[model samples]
Target chain A: MQNKITIKNLNAWFGAKQVLHDIDIGIEKNGITAIIGPSGCGKSTFIRCLNRMHEVVPYAKASGKVLVDDRDIYDSDIDPVEIRRRIGMVFQKPNPFPTMSIRDNVVAGLKLGGLKDKKILDTMTEESLKKAALWDEVKNDLNKSGVSLSGGQQQRLCIARALAVEPEVILFDEPCSALDPISTSKIEDLMLELKEKYTIVIVTHNMQQAARVSDHTAFFLYGKLIEFGETDQIFKKPKEKSTEDYIIGRFG
Target chain B: MDRLKLSFFRSSRSKLSGDFIFEAVVGLFALGILILAFLLFRELFIESGLSRKTFGLSFLFTSTWDPVNEIFGALPFIFGTLVSSFLALLIAVPFSLGIAIYLSELAPEKLRTPLSFIIELLAAIPSVIIGLWGIFILAPFIRDYLAPPLSTYLGFLPLFQGPMYGLSMLTGGVILAIMVIPITSSVSREVIMTVPTHQREAALALGATGWETTRIAVLPYSRSGIFGAVILGFGRAIGETMAVTMVIGNSPRISESLFSPSYTMASVIANEFVEATSKLYVSSLIEIGFLLLVISVIINVAARILVWKLLKVEGGKVA
Candidate 1:
């Protein structure tokens, strides 16, 4: 399989404290790779580093090379705005702009990309919603305020919003931790289907979810990657003691 | 066989009485404000009865202010107050927004604290002291430098046609604009800062530029609060007395020129109230005071309603 993203010697810091230790990994194109770790294990920080979002936080810095399709994303000439466009992100909370309507929320990224044709926006809105598996329920109420939706629907809307931008890779930072079981399954199914077309990196606290949805699983502990392998191999016969211990419910 | 249960009135007698007394006391506190307002209006109306009877509604529309003949009208003061306050808002809004944006979004963390402290210090300077500075520093600067160049180029416009006087409506407005910046900027900064981090992230994640992110997310979220701040500033501006009196030249006439001397309601009352020799003159001044109070009350009520509706329309929850 061809790799879409390659990382080498990634180190991140929050002021004086280094949160992400030296790490190296490659993510395959058109597949789901899950990053599983306990809290404060730098899973979020690692994904944030891919889009240069970690550096946006005051006093936070990173020294690393993140390559998207053989082009180093961390190069001085590369703009973070362009990098973020190529790699979209979904936050943990279902944070739809409260002032915007459902239709407006879905097309927000497109508008930011400077797409203003009403007909195109209308078509894309429906298509993105369908891709996110939310069109059937929300098609009739497109004008409703985004915040008025249920939590599950809001998450789906955010997914649709991310899809509208047509990013090559999408990052999920615990996208379903706040969702119900039904909603979680729906998103999981959606992600599985999306992996056929777009590369996805999911940071999940749920180990079972990582095993169920991801083609590959990477285990992170104390800002270090302990093991990266096929999903079944990582879950069933992890090579590292820490990885096996984590998978089997030992100390996180 | 049926047993009768206690009626709500009889069963909850102690609770009902307790609620009644509690509500009455709370209602009395509410009624106290209403009574005080009513008393204030009644006294002002009675004290200004001479002007009201003699001039009727023409008192507002007429421009005459002859203390000797006791022919008093409030049009000049009203016009001056409206124009000066409007001009102040025009000058202050842009500068205030800039300060707010810089402090909340762009300023370095180390610089933000001291700069915010400086703005608070601006607010604490007494109005009389500001007036003193206006007379000594601001008026001369305007007369010597600003007015001549502005009049030379823009003299075709009636607003810039009149001869320059050191003390004029423009001087008062510029000083008022300075005084208002502190309140407007501080409130706007707080409002912008209250927008949730996720909102900013959401916009940035869409590949929007920093300015675009602020425009789409931060600004729309805090618009109502900013509007409330502007309204508060406007209210403060109209009610300002000593500083405006010092710089506005105490001229009681309708004038289009920024450089022309003019008067406002509060300034007029402050200038003439203590010096009035006749009952009619004093009554006219009280009428002016009543008019000022009424205008302020209307503004406050309108602002409250507008802000409430704005909050409903925007529906932005600050996290």
Candidate 2:
């Protein structure tokens, strides 16, 4: 299988405080890989580095190589804008552009890309909403403000916006952490379905969720990856004692 | 319960406690302002009684201002104020928006804060200094060079067809435009910054350029607040007295040309306030003041209503 991304010897920091320490991992194309860790274990930091989103925060720096399809993303000549174009991100909260209509929100990414054709935009809008499983609910009120939707619907709308750009990889930074159980399950199912067409990486605190959706699991602790393997192997028979302790809830 | 009762007894309650005294003082302060407003209205009514008796409501419509026989009308002043203020907004809004966008989005992190502070400081400079600078420097330059050329091409416009006087409504309006820019730009910058980070990020992630992201996301998100800021700046332009009075030539006759000297309600009041010898003259000026106060209040109320309506459109979550 072709590897979608390769992160090698990755070390990251926020000012003087180091976060990720020598992390090396390869994620396969069209696969769902879950990064499971306690809060502040640098899982979110690691994902943000993939698309250079972490650089938005002040005093943040990262070293080592992150490769997407053999291109070194951190190379001096490589543009962060291009990396983000290839790898889209969804945040923990549903942040739809409140000023835009539901239909406009779906086509926002395309419009931002400078695609102005009305017919093309219409097709993309419908297709993106369908892929996000929000077309049925929002189709009637397409002209209403995106903020008028329920929280769960708004999150799905954001997902549709990301999809509209036709990115190869989608990174979820604890996307459903702010949703109820039903919304969470729906998003989980959407992720599984999404992986058939696009590579998906998810950061989650719930081990059961990691086992349920991800084909592979990488467990991080104290800013270090303790174990990485098949989901069943990582959960049931983790070779590292720390990984086992974490998976069994003995300690975080 | 016994301990609480003992503590309560130990802390003696006076007739006028700190909270009551503080409330009383603030209450009296608020009442003082209300009383001042009432007195101002009463005085204006008394002073305007002559104009009401002589010119009647035509005082507002008549353009001829003859102070020789004490025949005073405010049509020209009102017209000048509205035209100049509107022209100032037309020039200042786009310029201020560009400054705000540059300060908020394009400027480097090292420069953003300092540049923003500088723009805000321009707003604090006394209007007299700006007026003086306009009178000596800007007015002469416009009259000698720019106005003559503009008139050569666009003189067909009634506003541009006139003698190139250094001090006229156009010169005053341009000066007022500079004055209003800092207020409009700073308020707009604050509003634009409040547009959620995610909106910009979302646009950027889709391969949008920085300019593209701002155009699609930042501008739309802050549209209502920006409108409100423009109205507030318009209010400042309308009420600005010292600088406008100096540059506007204090002409009270109505003219079709912006290059002609004209006077605004504010400039008229300020120019005549110290020189009024007659009770009726003072009262007319006071009535002008009353009109200005009412106009400012109306602008503020309209701005608030627009903000409320915009919020309602945005899911009714008031800022």
For candidate 2, the per-residue lDDT at B166 reads 93
Give me the displacement of residue A9 in model 1, in angstroms: 1.3
What does candidate 2's lDDT look like per residue over B1-319, in tens digits? 5323423224445526565566557878988999998987788777777767777788788787666567777888889899889989999999999999998888877899999999999999999999999999999998999899889999999988979779998998999999999999998888778777767776766667788889877898889888988998899999999999989888887788889898999998887889888766776777777778888878978776765555454332223
**Can you write out model 2's per-residue Cα lDDT over A1-252, one digit (the tens) per residue?**
788999999999999999999999999899999999888999999988888888766679999999998999999999888888889888877878777889888888777667899999999999999999999998899999988888888889989999999999999988988888898888899999999999999999888889999998999998999888889899888999889888889877
- Against the native complex, each candidate's DockQ, computed on alpha carbons, is 0.51, 0.51
| C-alpha RMSD values across all candidates | 5.3, 3.8
Model 1, runs deviating above 4 Å: B1-46, B298-319
Q: Give the per-residue lDDT digits (tens) of candidate 1, residues A121-151.
A: 9999999999999999999999998888888
Clashing pairs for predicted structure model 2, backbone only: B47-B283
Question: Model 2, residue B174: what's the lDDT?
Answer: 95
TM-score of 1: 0.89
Candidate 2, position A11, lDDT: 94
